[model samples]
Target: EVAPQCRTASAAGFFAVAMYYQGADHASFRPLCPAIVEPQHYVREEPLFSSMAAGERRAVRRRRLGWFAHQVHQNSRTLIGGWVTGLFGAIATVPMVARILAPRLTSQIRESMGSLVRPPATELHLERLGNNPGSDPESMGYSLDEMSQIVVRILQDIGMVKDFPPTIVFFGHGSGSLNNPHESAYNCGACSGGRGGPNARAFAMMANDPRVRRRVSQLGIELPDEVRFVGAYHNTCNDDVDYYDLDLLPRSHRELFRGIESDIIETRARNAHERSRRFESAPLGLTPQEALEHVEERAEDLSQARPEYNHATNTLVTVGRRDWSRGLFMDRRAFVTEYDPAVDDKDGHILTRILQAAIPVCGGISLEYYFSTVDVEGYGCGSKLPHNVASMVGVMTGAASDLRPGLSQQMVEIHEPMRILFVIETTAEMLSRIIVENEGIRRMVEGNWVQLAIIDPSNSAIQRYVDGHFEPHLVSDMQLPTVQSSMRWYRGQRDHLGFATIQEPESDQPMNSSESNASAAGALA
Candidate 1:
């Protein structure tokens, strides 16, 4: 079936050749017989295709296409069309083109002229910024009641109700890579395959609203007046973070906010170093800056195969408080969503919301990566190398093949094919109810699309949900490699390492997971 079919029993520009075993032919031409069952076996020649994938094929194809498209000048129509358009525009549209570009040109010129002196920071005057009346359905355009509900729910989930952190950073995630077809797949799962930075920004803006704060007070979730919400975007590719609306932060909190820059730097470096271990080209024993530089360059490199493995080895989705796994080094695999079952109304209202959202988004991403890794040809686009961005819709193997689906081979090569272990901090009964209520979520659970774990709100007991019932997850207290920090753990190791706990650098500091949990619990109580 892979070969083209023959027709009309003859050819002018084509010839046919047949190779068969000596025992295969029948006795008489007029006599008919059933086809032979098996081959006696003879010679088999090596195929022309090397199975070279992704960047290799892309490098060769890009050069050949470049030569043909540019040096060879094959597409004369497009070149001549450009030339004709330019000439026509020059002859007739000087004023029109200028008019079109005037505002943009003026702005660019003004900015360029002002570049000598340092520009004062752009002030985010939220106090003066009036809310749009028609944007929201609420009478005030900003509903404090709804805002308080969302704010309180989020705060309670993270286990920081009474003792609010001076500056809480919401790190909405997304990825960056070059020549990758499944780039959007690496972005914030909750944002409908878009960048989550804007969503984070909106959430921060809502949290900082005084009007919303007053409403929150009425609801009994008293956020300290001094506490601030900072929205940030975490670049999953290189681990670089961009803080948004920092100028809006009160002047008193400016120094405290500035202090977080070092932590961000540390995080980026550590994450970059950890990721660099997976890449074949990255040198061992590298500093943070060097590691980050390599990754940044790797993403831009046209020939590099894996530009940051998107969600590879993502097996865990811990939906309890961040306290349970705060210092646990998950190799950038776990989706740690915060949710506190104790604070929410006993009907599993908040737990339902968290599970309903996280299950589908995380499950879809995990399953898609799993299937693609399992069967690249059947379930995924074979390699990004031969893929042409067809009409900016989907990719194609060649000019006339069917549009390929799912992830490319490069993205999922290291992905462990498994159902996502969704750890929720709620009762088993509550989880059962939530699953039964939402048909889509129920399909995910009952259909084995996602495995659910109901963590007891008060303790470390994790109950696994399977076949419409819950059983305790038999956790093995296995001995694994120990490291002080994530960077230290993954420093020189290339292969996958086992689970680990974050060892505190200082003796007086709190235990990574337990101490934080204990403090948060005490404060909230």
Candidate 2:
């Protein structure tokens, strides 16, 4: 049923259209629907019929009738002209009039229209001086005091600080090779006083910035005595320069320093030896089975080392083999279970629960996932490992609150997961052969026995996995061609790749027997 107000408004609109059409130009207006009566019915009959006197009255009557007829003809022309004019006026003015009255007519429609016309959200604004994109890092932007104040405001908004403060950490990165001009002066001597170079000066400037200092104070974030910075080198020959420059940062930045150092060391070590020989030679990977065993053993060792420290701590550990073919025959579930036992406990259970909840929100489980693969032969670490690890940590930290109330409350308190990822790159032909040559590995994932998510950033065999019933996803940015080009341009540069989490089936309900039967029948028949 139509709303009463809607009906009334529509009637008013129709009436307005009729009135406007009546006043419009005659030629422009035509009857939209057929007229029920002729024009003669509309003419006035009084004055023309008034003459009379007996026998003369009859003659008078005849004259009066003729006059009346002429009058009727004239009036008909006037009425027709009015109708045409009104029609054109109605047609021309309706849209403009509607727009003018729209706001008063429907508040909800107005709001929807406004939103439809609005632009996308803007990025965070940086308040700085000068147009120099490449200014001396220390001298650019607002003063250190200003930065501190801004930080304070952010902390206040987040409710992280009600005058409560947290420790502050500064991580830095730059090009620092023999080829660069400022290679020798790794630290910001200008920031520091004469006792050091700009290092202290830089920190002092940052601390002095009202915005920065206030934010730091509000967040209760304290900066350590040392600052950590990572410098990139052009070649392996310049490794020494990169190493020494790293020490220039404050001692407080030591932890940050160690992490980057460890990554570089690991990447270098991996690159030095042959892919086949490295596993066989090192105690870490003696055999294909042993390598798989090592991953499980490492998972346990790492889990034990960290433990579930508190209600807030979350952990993510990913272990991939360089040679998946070598472990093709190995039982994936056996290895995953042995290696990552924690996954079977509370964390895994909660993750599964969250997935179930999210399914309704996101529509379905056939979402795409992206993965990366890097050439192990290269001197630099590939994008796959770092990207996966970072993404996992981000998801755990970012979505912690959304998963559960208790988890959300412990968001800041929880320790981020320690991630381990592996990457291997080979030609397309070789990859195709590997899948055929190593059916065991393919079956491990396709059989749905292993609770793991595999992403093919390269997109090579990713479709095959999808076709085989494994939820393989392609992250377009991580495709082999793109990654290779990136590596070539920025070999030593640190870049984040993409990653997706491995989620278990959300519900305990078994697959429908009918659906399974249909699928089986379709396959066979």
Candidate 3:
């Protein structure tokens, strides 16, 4: 019954064998069927798989295990290969992606953070002048008069001040001591008092002086309506002080002036604190605030007691805190003044000394004044004005050019019969210009000799010239004397000599085919 039930199962039926027999005459085989049992009994009975041979069971389990293992291995290999391919692809594309994104990212970051980045500090100092005892020109460790003279000379050399003087604006730093005991001492003389205080008196006097104005006018410099007077005040305690007169200078000079002033104040305070002796006494008597107040009062009294100098109306003072020990000192003034180039001794005074040294050999000069204490340290010698002044002058003069385009035109005319050579590279750009903007080129060409030469290395015309053993003329395209193929043929020379006299086109002569070929060959060559 069990055998029949097993044989009736689908698995048993599928596995049933069909036999084949071979004989001498003919042979045939038929399907072999197993015995069957009742379906009800087979359904009710549990199969005894343990009764099967161990080897057969083992074989079935091995096949199932092998199939599972094969599937796992195949899946792992596919996943690993895909991962590796993706990683490699990403690595290869990184550079291209970075190249596309980097500039845009950088620009965005710069735009976002631009306001936070500080400008580079200026290295310029204003020379100290007048009654303060410590206000020795040498003690500020810089010479202002010398710088002034140098500036004057530069202006003359640049032809900005031919016979007439230019209006000059001077900027200066303060030199005085701070008033607080806890505050550090500084050499900020100009900022000893409050805004519009005594240190600014001298400049005020100069600005208002009719004689000074008349003298300046004679030199050809016209002062603008708004006068600027910038001063650097030292910190009495910890390099923390409000700049009282930052508004004194014109808005144009504010950014640079503020940076310089701040740097000086910080440096001077830092140095003073570094050199100061620490207090050894115990705090048995006064509170910190009281002590601070007491020190500040004493400083204020001292500053008030000091004699004040009379300055011009336009002048404004920036005072350091009261605790500064260096006392009040006046910084140099920025004003428009003219010095006689022939009579001015560059070494005689601070102003003239700089002028003699700074005048360019070419004999014209222009200067921009950047007055700051930082400049004192870096440019302790006299190298301060040239670098900053040149840039300022360029800006100013460039503006002048915009105002009067006729200036360049007139200058061009003055240098006329100017043999301008418009050498076109014979590129697509050149061809386009000749074809599309031919009229403009014609106008330019009419004024000067237009030389058209094939620059494309692959061009037949260029190749022909190269083959002819003639060197191609290496003239600048935009330079004067535009030489074309026709001109070269007319000259009867393969190469145009440098700066030759202009020759008129001959009416009776026509270029022969041989000459044309020779010219083309020479150009190509």
Measured by lDDT, the strongest candidate is: 1
lDDT of 1 by residue, 375-415 (tens): 99889889888878788788889777898888888888888
Which portions of model 2 miss their true places by more than 4 Å? 1-127, 130-214, 226-267, 271-525
Model 3 per-residue lDDT tens digits across residues 1-525 = 001100000011101111111111112221111111111100001112342354345445556666886875565468686676666666756544443345334334544664332221212112334323132333321133333332333233222333221112222222222221111012211121121111122232233334444554455544334333222222342223333234344565565444444444444433332212122121324433344433333233322211111111111111111111011111111111222223323332322222222121001111101111113222121221121112322211222221111111111111112121221222333343433333443433343222223334234233111221224555445343433222232232211133322233232345433222110000000
- The estimated TM-scores of all candidates read 0.71, 0.19, 0.19
lDDT of 2 at 141: 39
- Selected candidate, larger TM-score, 1 vs 3: 1
Candidate 2 TM-score to native: 0.19
User: lDDT value for candidate 1?
Assistant: 0.60
Residue 84 lDDT in model 2? Answer: 63
Question: What is the C-alpha RMSD, rounded to one decimal, of candidate 2?
Answer: 35.8
Query: In model 3, what lDDT does residue 42 have?
Result: 6
Strongest candidate by TM-score:
1
**Local distance difference test, candidate 3:** 0.26
